[model samples]
Target: MKGASSEGRFVIDLPDSDAALALAGVGNQTLHSIEALTGASLVIRGLELVVAGLPTQLEKAVGVLELIRPLWQEGQIISSVDLQAAFKAFDKGYKEDHASLSDHILVRSKRGIHLRPKTIRQKAYIKAMETHDLTFGIGPAGTGKTFLAAVLAVRMLMERKVERLVLTRPAVEAGERLGFLPGDLQQKVDPYLRPLYDSFHTLLGMEKTNALLEKGVIEVAPLAYMRGRTLENSFVILDEAQNTTSAQMKMFLTRLGERSRMVVTGDITQIDLPGGVLSGLVEACDVLEKTDGIAISRLTAEDVVRHSIVQKVVDAYARKDS
Candidate 1:
């Protein structure tokens, strides 16, 4: 390793070529990403990275690189998600050493792909899930609300914390009628539940997921199916909850039986309820805002971890709505 320093610039030498390559990404794409994110001029020569910028920008850039170093050492494939998360953490003065922010492993896919929260709000959401029997994750699209809930529910089932995983959502369509559709109740609701199935498939693989569904270890159904039963010893997730009416929401919440956990996630702004009908999610948040054993995590556009343009799009719509 080598070192060089000046008034406003520094050089970090990476002795291991593989680690350096991992950090720089293929074709220097990661380096360019870091440069763009931190507004720092970064040049890679051999295994050394020379960073030059305003003193504060350079310091933050180096902080991000240092934060990611351990992930690379542990053979974790760094992605743009990692970069964005690191940048957001530093920019917001969030304590970067939190385990959920970097090293917490939520679940491992059947193929060994590790999934974890990619933002601070996501970390908070996961922590809430662990601590509270009921948690509400309200956020915009791409904030990982439904996805994380599904992952945690699956993990709880595998760990024996829960006997079953029940996933449900309202079958409301976005200004579309379901009366003209054919087939039985399952067929009518399967389309609305496809997102939950996709999450299950990603984490458990298609064959295993189908097997679990067949055995009833995993159940995906419309919210209407929850009417008359107490969900006991189960990890239940209500997705697209904003589409639920007040009565429906109350019914769902009261269905939580002993030794059960419920995670309700929805985007309030995207509610598809009939005109003048208040969303159950909105009403529940208002009523439960201060209740014990209930956690509410509000994620904003800044927590949107999809493509970069998604944050911009959310911001644009938010501005327009305002």
Candidate 2:
């Protein structure tokens, strides 16, 4: 298929140079991915897009392009997730579901940066967060569980939907010994919450993030500090809930006050608790599986939007565990 297994070519005209480049991606890498995945050679010449190879392959590749046309037509950047979603539609014959994946923007920053769900499960997760007062997002790393929650929280704060945003996590080490580290309590705890802060910094620049923090509009603290307080009119996120004890999870969930929203996100497979301790995230999911006014969005390796290798790594580990 790489060297022309069949004598055929398909040509289609794009609307403009922007759409052509958007479809081809930077340095034509998107075309390379499409070609490698579909066994069709794809190239762009000005506004004319060419697909060459076996007739069936050409048709399939063109079908994928049509499915993802919603993105490129809007000058949106497409990634491996988009390609995978397209291939999934091609195989399952669910093109309409795949096409709606790019239909909505979750949030946009002041600098014109748009953040949206990269997969179907993510879209559902966002919707769950919007509808439910308390939601649990269980998944592996790189699934955007906590990141999406942070983006929505930021949007709520900016739009005055919420009075403040509170980001908290259990102060648990992940397979690393931190007891001997030389720092105060806050200094020692900063590293654990750094990832959550990184997401805010990306959505809002460092200057704006610091300003919000200084104004107390955004609060980052450990879960222990959340005890004995009602978080009213706030968007609260508890990261790494898998490390929380049953009592701790119950305490955190009870802290939800009127007009407050809470999201608990964690990866149960990566729990680093003591041998006999149960993960609060696991326990909560089991207890609340049938509860009303709450949602549990479980993302899998397919929902991972990081580099493709990360998905492979998750799948490999999952296979070994299974």
Tell me, by TM-score, which candidate is best: 2
Q: What C-alpha lDDT does candidate 1 achieve relative to the native structure?
A: 0.86
* Residue-by-residue lDDT tens digits, candidate 1, 1-322: 2343566787887767776777778887888999999888888788677888888878888878877766655545678878887877777777454334557888887766578788777888999999999999999998899999999999998899999999999987823466667878788778999999999999999999999999999999999999999999999999999999999999999999999999999999998888999999999999999999999999999888778788889999999999
In candidate 2, what are the lDDT values of residues 27-89, reduced to their tens digit? 889899899889998888888888988887887898888888877876767788778768877
Each model's lDDT comes to 0.86, 0.87
Model 2 scores what on Cα lDDT? 0.87
Residue 256 miss distance in model 2 (angstroms): 0.4
Best by lDDT: 2
lDDT score, candidate 1, position 49: 78
What is the TM-score (0 to 1) of candidate 1? 0.89
Task: Give the poorly placed runs of model 2, Cα more than 4 Å off.
Answer: 1-7, 109-111, 174-183
